[model samples]
Target: MRRPVTRRVLAALAATATGAAICVAVTTPQASAAVGSATGFATRNGGTTGGAGGQTVRATTGTQIHAALCNRASSSTPIIIQVEGTINHGNTTRVSGSSCNTAADVIELKQISNVTILGVGNGALFDQIGIHIREASNIIIQNVTVRNVKKSGSPISNGGDAIGMEANVRNVWVDHVTLEASGGESEGFDGLFDMKNNTQYVTLSYSILRNSGRGGLIGSSESDLSNDFVTFHHNLYENLDSRVPLLRGGTAHIYNNHYVNIRESGINSRAGGRAKVDNNYFRNSKDVLGTFYTNQAGYWQVSGNTFDNVTWSSRSSDNNPAGPNPTSNTSISIPYPYSLDAASCVPNIVSQTAGANKGIRTSNGSCATQNPTSGPTPGPTGNPTPTPSQPSGTNLSIGAGSDGSSKASGTSYGDVRDGNMSTAWSPSGATGQISIKWDTATRVSRINIREASGSVGNVRAWRVLNHDTGAVLATGSSAGVITFTATSLRKITFEITSSSGTPRVAEFETYAS
Candidate 1:
């Protein structure tokens, strides 16, 4: 039930001089990686290889595909554009020579780069039209099916994310697309694949995020801890309700995806965000992985997951209850390195290789069987909690701590002390402060603050001083792990002042208890 577009560009245009349907360029389709053909981002870092050997324009009207990307010549070559119909933008037009800014909506790949927007032949819908992608990079959006993109009051794309991805956007890869919206944001809709600020090495494969309640987000404040290396494999999050993708601290790697009928909450790794929940396949879904609705606490490393009639939501203070009997670790390190198919062969290998007209044919399930392991066999036993583990302490402030100020990145502020939850110490501003000193006067009581994955810098009513003597010791507003007892302390200060934004501190441990 998606079709209704046309706000101008009416005609069989080829008028004036000859035919109205001009914009035809064709070339690259030598089939590099195969899927729907134009070989666009299945994988190929940030510079992009989409539109492979370059040149292929087609278009039916999204304003002639923004006038063939405003007559592309450079953005580093590579271009494929195919599209076929349904592009109703309803206004804000401007893409005749290239900066392609349809701002109020529809088609706008602002700082363009190697592009690839395919949706060829028969059905290529973009109905209420969204597709923004600001400071662009190597992009690729395949198969197409964007619906209801209203909200013209200008939140730009957030108010209508069918595919937004903002600023300095890096290596993108959205495939077999199909984003819908019926409610959320008062029915105007938001997010289907929304990534903000410093969007990074991206990948949203075999896509199909149904109905919508935001199935996307990497980093967009909580002091926006720079978005990290992302990846959500073999996608299909149906009938959504929560951020099947709302991650802030970044390092996501959610595998084999297929979460059906999720009515409330699922995969919400908070602040010091870190996900690796692999081999997934949830069913009736409830609290499919918690920390949820904010308490700022996110970390997951679960393995080979598979839940059925799921329903969990008990343990509080960083809510926990993600189903099945799983637990995987090693934090997150997927820069690129594939092969891992087993969560009991996720719903028959995601119903035979996820999406985008599988012509490349998928599924190898049962990993070529051969298992007996003698005796006792059973499934779904007990122990349901366990995700937020890694947090002990020896970290007396790595390399001795001294950053009068920091938004971080040298490896993101020394990993708090390198105990590593993933690595973080971020200190962006709005009203900043961060301190930790020691020349020799140790034996501290406790001061664990592991919250750095974004929602808005946490830290609210801060205090926790000792900075040599003008003592304050402990105060609230949260980041976690508080316990004061200071004895021969040299210095310690964490003057946040106030926050619901911009707070990252992977682990600032000082425990002696």
Candidate 2:
């Protein structure tokens, strides 16, 4: 059974989508601010809020990571560890403590709860080392890279998996990370991300797993069926041999991911594993989806997926490819809310936002990045207009072209300049921008913004900018006559920086006073 949803997930969606900081904790040497909110299955089981409002520390080596955990007041005490520089076997050692179960040559998060490991500054790289999570809950690992970890080599760690979770793990989120290997198990490498032994309520987002034989697995074997409720979205899987991943049992929601160059197989859902596959992009792959290697008969509910140049094998006891022409074989009911990008745009979006050291950027659910402005601007303090009166002068926006960073469904960019109060434009999220453009440069000192009927008091803060020069024209708290020094510009943008609700703009009028 699925867990209940809470208000924390909604708050995270609002804050991160609006480019507002979801402050985990801020201390010297590291800023514990999350780049994006938790989505997918992680929003379940009371939501994943790792180390929020907890003590923050900094770490430069793997041993320091263990030390921070060992130094915590208790195993379940919330703590955020901001990591930087390279962490390898040379600097990692087991630290014995009541709060930690760490080991040498690896970053171990064992028997712990409410902890966060975040990469900061030049970023954290686990070179030839892996992260092992065992019997842990409510943990997060973000903005880090783990590469070339091996199990059978001279320098082995985490049994060769880049990141492995097992033994009753729950509510863990791993985001904006990169896990890669030199080759496969024959080359001393293993799965990039693996979960087994009753693991549940986990999410892996905005990550890249490449150049490995196995991407990951849900269960250790066909009978290890207790693991379930995993989500994989906005990830890139490239140059993988097979098992991307080999799902043995339980349910997985895989969407908006880009898969390229699969040598043998992809998404080997078998042993009764069920996957809800949606809006994914597969290019140059072989047997991208199906029940492979096992006859246990896994099921899939496929929709909106694009298979470009993906090859399929004949249906047999060992190979059952879903494609050649894929269709849904089962139905799944997802519990949480989410936005899906078009399959055509998955590659572009994942390439820019996935992996580490990418400034922790995320999609605004509308295929646009949230941070388009130069820097953070202060919130508006001007008094609000309870009811904005229509301006008298000629509305310059009536005939101008209109565009925006993003728009809500059933709303249009043209609605803000349409001159009809009944029709309006609303952003996909709490904050967004709407701009008016002209064929030639236009000059105006005064502008009036009229909010839509039901959304009058929704807008809390706003800024008018000269879109041509990226200059702020005026800052205010409400929709009304906003005045600044008369300047000529080809385009002007009215950006809603913060809002109490989903604000809507009925009309944007410009006048020369």
* Model 2 pairs in collision: none
Candidates in order have lDDT scores of 0.62, 0.80
Candidate 1, residue 401: the lDDT equals: 62
**Tens digits of per-residue lDDT for model 2 on 419-463?**
899999999999999998899999887788777754543565788
Candidate 1 local lDDT, 1-513, one digit each (tens): 323222324223121123344545444333331143212223545344555545566676676677666666655566677776677655224554434444435677777777777765554677777888888787777767787675644333435888888778888777657687776766668777778788877777656677777677788766787877777876778778888887878778888777876788888878888888778778777887866767777788887787877887777665665544545434666555566667654543443334433222233334321222211111111211111123366667666764445554443555665667666666667445566677888777667666543321234456777777868876643345566664667667666676533556666666555
Candidate 2 segments whose C-alpha is farther than 4 A from its true place: 1-33, 372-513
| Model 2: lDDT of residue 267 | 92
Query: How far is each candidate from the true structure, as Cα RMSD in Å?
Result: 19.0, 13.5
State in Å the error of residue 157, model 2: 0.5
